[model samples]
Target chain A: MSDIYTNNYVIVAIFLILGVLLPVATVSFVGPLLRPKKPTREKQTTYESGNIPVGDSWVRFNVKYYIFALMFVIFDVETLFLYPWAVAYKELGLFALVEMVIFISLLIIGLIYAWRKKVLEWN
Target chain B: MNTLLQQAPSWGTTLWFIIAAVLLLAVVLGFVTYAIYFERKVIGWMQLRIGPNRVGPLGLLQTVADVAKLLLKEDVRPQHADKALFTLAPILAYAPAFAVLAVMPFSESIQFADLGIGLLYYIALSGITVLGVITAGWASNNKYSLIGGLRSAAQMISYEVPLVMSVVGIVLLTGSMNLEDIVKAQQDVWNIVPQFIGFAVFIIAAQAELNRTPFDLPEAESELVGGYHVEYSGFRFAMFMLAEYVYMFGMGALITILFLGGWLPIHPSLDFIPGIVWFILKFSLYVFLQFWIRATMPRLRVDQLMSFAWKVLLPVALFNILLTAVVVSYQNGMF
Candidate 1:
């Protein structure tokens, strides 16, 4: 990569490191110095609205989230395709328009299929 | 900063980059502190109640005081919690929220990283926050936090589609994902006017993505009991709070860039005002709208939240991109 391009990301990398450092420093080092450290067994127990906790929380959650994740992956890929096309749209002109229309319509059809399959519903 | 981007790697440039990043972090922290104070004051006034009067003048230092208290409180971890992930979650969530600001052009000259794919950088980093939320919930080993985390993950991902799709209209119009180019392309007219459908979809999806009221399903307090951070206390909890507000700041700046014409005065005659002032004015309008909506709107049902994103916002965003593409091609005499 060119100096400019490489330098741009260098700035971003610095910012990311600083971003991580801020919360880590505050929550661990700086905070530990100032904060109290009184921990009882009850205080460290998982809270369940003041009631005694029951089964483990790591049990299987509703499958709806996984369904949404599948839908998201599909649509997210569609979005990825759309972005590059959109960025190049001015140069590509009418040919790209027709192609994108066909592309999006196909995804809309997939969305409709999901709707019909009732995967979009919360229940 | 632009000049620095053209230079080869060196200790001097690296030191300058570090200094710039630190300065920007200070500014962001200032923004977060006052944003919380402003949100409380705005919502409190709307509810006809006084807010934070005991802190500094006109409650200006309310959030500062609150942060001090949070830092002083004991950090607690549930006994069964995954210790490493629990400790890591807040940093994971917050780092991206702050890092995304690197690409945000505060004015024509004020951006830090001048990445070509600035919009993509922002979107990609913001999405990582959902992972942090899921980790916090799973690591907490609490039922409410687990449900909250899953709900939030689902909500964030669902809205994220529409959010990215909606901006494709602007990307199509400007033919560039670099935010500076997008803003410069709006010299004649802002994207919101021609890309009205996209703007509408973007704002709605942005609201959901930020988890503001009317779309705040993941952290629904009444039912979920403080949601994903229910098990987090003290400085760790403060990290989540800071991330949420900082994300709001980022989204506000982005909306200003994509739709509101970042730092562009409404009229040529009004150009005497500095660009940064115009930027702040437009950005503050967005921040205020967030608070106003938070005060006014009721939270949506979980099912309603999911359906609305997939059904309403997604389709609208898709239609917007198609509409923008057709119009742009026609304007280019390609029809």
Candidate 2:
């Protein structure tokens, strides 16, 4: 509103109009211009591309993937925080070192749980 | 915050904000558009075909054409779908792509935000995309989307660990979280020369995080039939496509920044190529390499995927971090 009311008004308003109208323009301009018009059952079908799609894609997955994923998120986030500590290493020194060790150790327990559960044992 | 803003130089801050936003938006939008094209071209080359030659010259404009076609298609929402969540999921999936770029340093001084806790912000923000996928998968109430979203949640969370650990070594060496500082440390020598193992681990984990190739169990067309996004059509579906390639380029850009020197050269003599150009070239190479790997490798079994991250990548990354700490400590003492 401020930009539209100020010296930047014209420029900002052009972008504003485009933002609202562009999608509408695209649908009309491009849809009819492209996509062949001879309506066939296959032409409109969700593109299996001449191959018959068999069996619904939804099926049970190994629940074990969930466990590993859970562990990954916890650890992934922990590692990310370490970047700041690494950067501030000079100012923080050994105090930072000790703090990181404690933090990493907490994440290691999740790793241990995965190992003990034998989720790591793949042939 | 208001007082701080009033006290500071507004021009430089505004300029940085604009530049960073432009770079971030351009990369996310441009990469997402072109990734589809690159994927087709690579796949076509492997299969010995011209590949979308009808669109623009050699199909250079094929993605634009495809995006246009998608926009025109019907955006069908299942009557049973939770309207609010259904409508919101694509934006949910896509918005994080832009947010994560806040932490990614395209070149020295070129970043959206230099929050002192940059790396942590990158990791934390990326996890938000999982919720978006889960939301899409759950809202559609399609069996396939539910399973796909479930698979995405599983795959990304699993891969995020090693990806973070891969950078732990670099952080140890640079002793700074500011991505620019990390890049500056590399002017003496790129971290890749010392942290080669970390670099390799990062690339592998990034591929998995972005759901490329073997780790793409979430969207495995042959198996789950388009996974979490199966119900989406037209522009909403295009949002998922956009989020995906943007994520890919984001990881590639992160890799370039963290491991490949973020536009620093092997020698000072090659400084003629501007830093941003060097960064972009490196990123493009990584993106191409991802396509190359996709054409060559087969998808892994679900069990194989979990075990590999837990047993293999985690161990290597942990070992790398410890080793880097010791080495960096010694180097610091010497200096």
Q: Write the per-residue lDDT of candidate 1 for residues B182-260, one digit (tens) a residue.
A: 9999999998999999899889989998988999888888999988999999999999999998899899999999999
Give per-residue CA lDDT, model 2, range B219-326, as digits (tens): 889878898888787777877777787777767877788877887865699888788889888888888898888889999887788778778898888878767766
Off by over 4 Å in 1: none
Q: Each model's C-alpha lDDT?
A: 0.90, 0.70
DockQ score for model 2, please?
0.18
Model 2 — TM-score against the truth? 0.80
What overall lDDT, based on C-alpha atoms, would model 2 receive against the true structure? 0.70
The weakest ten consecutive residues by lDDT in model 1 chain B span B319-328
Q: What is the lDDT of residue B152 in candidate 1?
A: 94
Candidate 2 clashing pairs?
A86-B175, A87-B175, A87-B176, A87-B177
Q: Candidate 1 DockQ category? A: high
Model 2 alpha-carbon miss at residue B137, Å: 1.0
Highest lDDT model number: 1
